[model samples]
Target: MNHRSDLETDGEPDFDNVNRSESECLVGWDDDNDPLKPSNWSNARKVKNIAPLVYCSFLTPLGSTMFAPAIEQVTKSFDSTNSLLSSFSVSVWILGYFVGPLFLAPLSEMHGRFPVYMVCNALFVVFNVATAVAPSLPALIVFRFLAGMFGGCPLVVGAGTLGDLIKPLNRGKVIALWSISVILGPIIGPIAGGYMGETVGWRWICWTLSIAAGFGAVVAFIFQEETYPLILLQRKAARLRKETGDSSLRAAAKPERNAAQIFARSIIRPLRLLFLSPIVSLLSLYQGVMYGYLYLLFTTFPTVFRNRYGFSAGSIGLVYIGLGVGSGISVPIVGFVMDHTAKSVIRKGRELNPEHRLIPLLPVCFCMPIGLFWYGWAAEAKTHWVVPILGTVFVGMGINTLIMCAMTYLIDAHPLYEASAAAAGAATRSLIGAVLPLAGTSMYEALGLGWGNSLLGFLALIMCPLPWFFYKYGGRIRTNPQFQLKL
Candidate 1:
């Protein structure tokens, strides 16, 4: 587990350096002047590095829900009277999220993070602009789908980049900052979209998002540097060859598989893990259910506030502030608990294993069921609005904890293939995002808010013990022959 920056030494270039290449050289051979390494960077510069990742996280989730408030406007403009079709305008982007990560995650592994990030984000920007100007509903849906496909890159790649810069011991805090965007962006977007759609028109929602994304792109170009270890190593290997006049310098850590082989394996690995590895299967199922529930809540919030509470569209958006607030409160707490628990477990003489990291999730697992029950029963009873909002707070806390623990565990389990492991998780969750919202309206209408949400909570209660089960048995499960082959 050598740090990526530790691979380089400042001696006369080993002309005969058969073990280095330009890309590999760039990563490990840190010069005093290497501005790319976050450790070698100034405080201001490190903040600048982190800023784009935060922005990227914000943009992706913002894009996911920005159109929710505008669904009515889009349906009216398109002259389509179907409610399902209208819902499609918002949910279809999530469909793109499902598709993009499968390929983009692998591409980042092959090409380096910066190139994939820039290209995919640029594609997102272009389609977002198109979405703003779409003349017809079909065109709008098409553009949104494409924009989402591109936007998915940031969600997967951002974690990989963070992994590159921060060691495991220091990652929790940095990851908490990164997680803020994911937690808050969905909650905030609808608030803005509600106001923007009501006042300026739904098209302006796209325009506003595009403008923000464009600014993010510019910031990323200026501040973000390549952080993938393999790509950096290749760069270093090339530099050494030039300096020492050695044509044979090669990266010590080249991928054993060639391009074609890597591509094939990348495409196949996620599927294999899903079916063959209980650890991946269980985690993916948990993450998917959580994400599905989140989207279901997002789709129903407008209806609950507008019809039941007589809130205007803009005011309905403001209610999302509760969700955002709850998530914000959870970030620091989860980060602290996660890091503290990890350290404490090691101190207690247990093996210094990542399974210990899963301990903090126990509270979140219990809280999820309680929150859902409170929300469902309270809303059904027509209690004060604050009761349901309190339930939402519990939900937010549970979601954040689940996500942080699941991802960290995956990264720990498969450090060699973190990008792919993350992609597998993202793929399952995004599919849930795409499908759950389409059914949300129907469920809420039939079951009413109280029972509909209670059902979700009960399911969570049943699943609450899942992480603990895995924590106790996961290391043995991971050692199975089938799991080893997938890894």
Candidate 2:
């Protein structure tokens, strides 16, 4: 009972019949096998397109923490010894992360992904260059903020692009691979920044990022293309209308929304959903705390190692090896574990549920508090340097695993609204990442490293029950009418 045309069913264009007296507009994929559909693209082509985009995403976190090892040098250069201001140089970029997604993510949905990729990324590079040559601390922070705003484009849009190209069944592996950029950026930033700041100068941190981002922009310009289905359909409709003089030509199911409406909704939808959805609220809170803690470490790690162990800048960066290696190794392992877990559940004659995807997060939840406690006490006791680094290893593995699980759960929960859901999560995390680190040094000063980290561990303990609660009650919450009652 296929009511669609032969050409449509067979995944071919019906150009021959387009000039007929009557014709229905073509829209969506011609069929599941349509060559132009992103999901149907060759695996090689998908990798080619996504590689540069993912590389560009690395720039955001790279820029976020690249200043960490240089904080002391930066203060000296400006003759301003304020620790708070130095921290601002690092955290203000997060301000842009918070604001960029609100407008940029929606804009990509409306105009298409390529333009955003090109323009915003170019701006990111420009500001990065400006950051390198800044005359004062104020100028440097301002440039950093601008760079972060534009740097956020890829973080916001890249997820949507991957969602477009990859089917849910196959996404876990790619998501895991793709997430390496997120984990490596900050972990490696301080390492590179430490060497450059100690040997060369802190200004080189910004200059180096500028060069890398500039190169990334060139790659994007060459390979990036419009991937949004609606935009593609609209183009097809316009071409058909022009060629056939058919004023009635239109895309199937394309809305008549104007730019303003699209823009407004793009900015508001995530905010609304974030506040209204209990599922989103809890997940955001969990992610926000973890992300904030990550940035706090970026600020505090150098201080701890330098004061306690008397490590040089370059040497202090080496301590990040524990976290970096843990995250790097865990991503692929977690991906296999998640996919295998999902398949195992399906084999038991049970329909797959999103809640099933949450199994990976359970072990991670327990690990977080344990890692924190171990890290705090070991460092407090002035145990061997390896002790605290070992603690960070556990922390890193737990965090990366938790993030993947939460992301997979959210995407599974709202397949159709993946972008909006992700935006909400990113906004919450970015805000925390932006604001929490400002207090990090002050907290360390007041409570010292031991009690300061202990407090964070306590918070992790309170939040540890989240994954279990979600695993058991997620289905009920999802099925509730309130799930649909959007703000």
Candidate 3:
């Protein structure tokens, strides 16, 4: 282990000396001296560190899509028009997520991670309970949106939490585990929701999610610790000053700002970056379109299977299993390939930068277009149901890989402002989710399933080369002043 004193000798208090007196000065300590650094944490502690974040990921997705199985019940009880209204129940929550991150991500930076997580999750749990018994469609929508606003915290903050607990070099494995929730949540939600809706009706969807979220909140309260470095340092400075009775001990501390100013800056910074940075804007748009397409497909699946193929609700729900399986398979394979590719490049006397991490996306880009075309056409032609299922499998593989690579690139490109970058991505994606479901029924009706899907596939083909083009040229583009490269 590298020692702190070797890095600096400014006569600041020795924070690395575990045996140092409580009265020692605390401010202006080097990060190398901070034993609380995620890299220095024990293995058991690290597991504890990541567990809540995974739960955070799981909780949000559960809230986002768990109601899919209950969509019919919700629509019928509320006298809804068709799957469109039911789709609204599912997609509207995601819409709230798009809006929440703009401000919430910044709030976490100012207030610390734990408080924001707990408060938001608590709000989610409460509103989720309200959604269970909502007597009217508008009430359901309102409650669901509130729940989503709270649920959105985990998606935005979880990555920052990971950064807090893990170093960049060791992050791949941890990120892979986090990816499981991202991929599996949508699949699992419908599976469980389908069964519960069949047995207990749609009201149980919200009730069940509320129960699960309540449990997760309890676990989080007990296990999750504050991980923001600045907040931790501030705490250390306060403790040392109190112990030593030295007014001048705080050398690195800055005057505290009011909440209004903090909130203003936190809310505005992402918007500023969104307008100023071409890379962020383009990437956000790309991710938004992809996410919109996913929700659109989700809305279409039930109609295709239930009306055309004549599958039972239970069986239709089982179709999502193919997506879950495909995503699960991709996670480990992608992780291994990413590691292998990086090592291979290094062995050839070339250092792999963040842009190099995007190489896997090239294959995914082609896979997505092909998979979309296969699924759309197979479903339209009413070919063997197996063919469409296989197409879904390919779609899953492509989506998982694209998400993994895109997110990795975002993090690598903006290590200092990852939360903001991720927020921007989430905002665009959520907006699409909110709007796409509303259009799915109309689109399919106007164009018919075969042509509607074919059109999507065609669009994917048009964008297929984007990842490769960026991988080859992103470094040069990032070097431009607008991208905000940390180095």
Candidate 4:
């Protein structure tokens, strides 16, 4: 008899509910207080597990855009002017992110995160080397994509590992910080990437990326622990069997499924959640647009500031610091606001719904367009460069707020299925991030900085209603069988 409920997390069947036929001793944690359990680890130990994971998360997204600052040099080196391919070079790394996890994430569950982290870092180094030494443009593009395909483990697996250690009550601050790392990579990469590409050659970008990944691999090798409960339990069971000479010692009477089945489910579940569930579809599309908008701005910043403001390729990334500053400042403020608001909601004795997470979005969503319109017109008029950069601070604030709101709401709503929901949303966001930036240069060329961004401002404006509408009706929509996705 299994007592599994849709509300339960971890997806492990309830071993306690079933009567054991096995006379052989079953293996579990030594007890609920077991020291070996990741959740039971001390704070310092959990940080040991998280530090390398966060570094990789930061590094991979950094890789996506580090190449952006040098796109022109890459094109020149190849002696090609195919405009689409140039932008594709930068965005295709993100495309690799979208494809990698469908299979690799499940594999991580099978092999554990330490192995995945080490293997991905090794492979990333291999392909980054290949990218640096590429003989042709096509070869360059293919190598970068392959690096990304293996390199996305950090994005897909990091949060799950955090969950393994930190319960939901204490997760917000750490997660917010970790989440910043993912966004930080893009913002931080250009500052280094632009200057390096200017001083050295564009190939140096790949060389630097390879070296950075190798460093992260060393950190993971030294510190990362196996955090997956099932895998740890399986290891314990195998150990117990060897010592006790009891072949029937088992982790759970039955595991979820074999590796193949788990892989198939991992690949299929996010797609199903994304397309079949309306709540997922809306929030994912909303988050996807926000992610795409950020990447588009990143890809075009060099062109926009360089052509209009007479910035050099090296110095153009400085404008991106406006975004970095904004997000950095927004993190603590958003964290405080979210924490305070949740406490207030609890005081009222009202039923908590995932929609409660949307409360912050009411004031936060409008900030983006304000930044867009302000920055666009200011830059278009050639006002002091400071004016446009200041406008981006507001845009940065909005982007961080919106992403956190959507992600938190999805996690709260899905409970046991949060990983699937996040994967669905992340895949959509990465897909859009990859495709949207390809349009950035052309959109600016046709409309000029002011109208092109004003167009985006309008898009942002239309999306502002999402949080409000969902806050009121999201619970009902989520519970409606018509909107629910079944495995």
Best by TM-score: 4
For candidate 2, write residues 1-487 as lDDT tens digits. Answer: 1223311111222322122225554544556677877777889888888999889988788888878888888988999977788887888888789889878876776678889889998999899999999999999989999999999888888877886788768875686667778778988888888888888899988889999999999998988778766577668778878998977776554555777977787777787778888998899889988888877787778888888888888877787778787677667777777779878878987878888878877877777777778887888889999999999988888777777788778878876666677778888888898788889889888987789888998998899899999999998998899678552
Q: How far is candidate 4 from the true structure (C-alpha RMSD, Å)?
A: 2.4
Error of 2 at 145 (Å): 1.7
Model 3 lDDT, residue 61, Cα: 77
lDDT of 1 at 390: 83
lDDT of 3 by residue, 1-487 (tens): 2224211122222344232335544354455636765556777887876787788788787667667656666777877876666788788988888778867776886778999999987998899999988989989989999898888787788877877777767876787678677667888887777777778887877888889889888888888888766577667767877987765554243335667866675666666656667667776777777777777777667768877788766666776776777677778777887889989999999977888767777777676667778887888888878788788777778777777777778767876666566666768778977887788778888988778878878887887877877888888888876566331
lDDT, candidate 1, residue 288?
A: 89
Q: Evaluated with lDDT, which candidate comes out highest?
A: 4
Candidate 3 deviant stretches above 4 angstroms: 1-39, 251-258, 481-487
Worst 10 residues of 1 by lDDT: 6-15
Clashes of 1: 25
Residue 322 local lDDT, model 2: 80
| lDDT at 27, model 2 | 44
**In model 2, which runs have C-alpha deviations exceeding 4 angstroms?**
1-32, 41-44, 167-170, 245-247
Candidate 4 C-alpha lDDT tens digits along 1-487: 3323222355333333213454744556665567867777999999998999888888888888888888888899999897788888888888998898888788777777778878888898899999999998888989989888888888878877887888657886787778878878988888888898889978998999999898988889899889877677778788878997878877754345787877888888888989888888998998888888888888878777887888877887688998888788777777787778888878998767788888878888999999999989999999988899999999898988888888889989987788888889889988998899889888888999899999999999999998999998898898998876776
Residue by residue across 152-249, what tens digits does model 1's lDDT show? 77786787677667655677678777876777789889999898888899888999989888888888988888877567667877887889886666
Itemize residue pairs with steric clashes in candidate 2: none
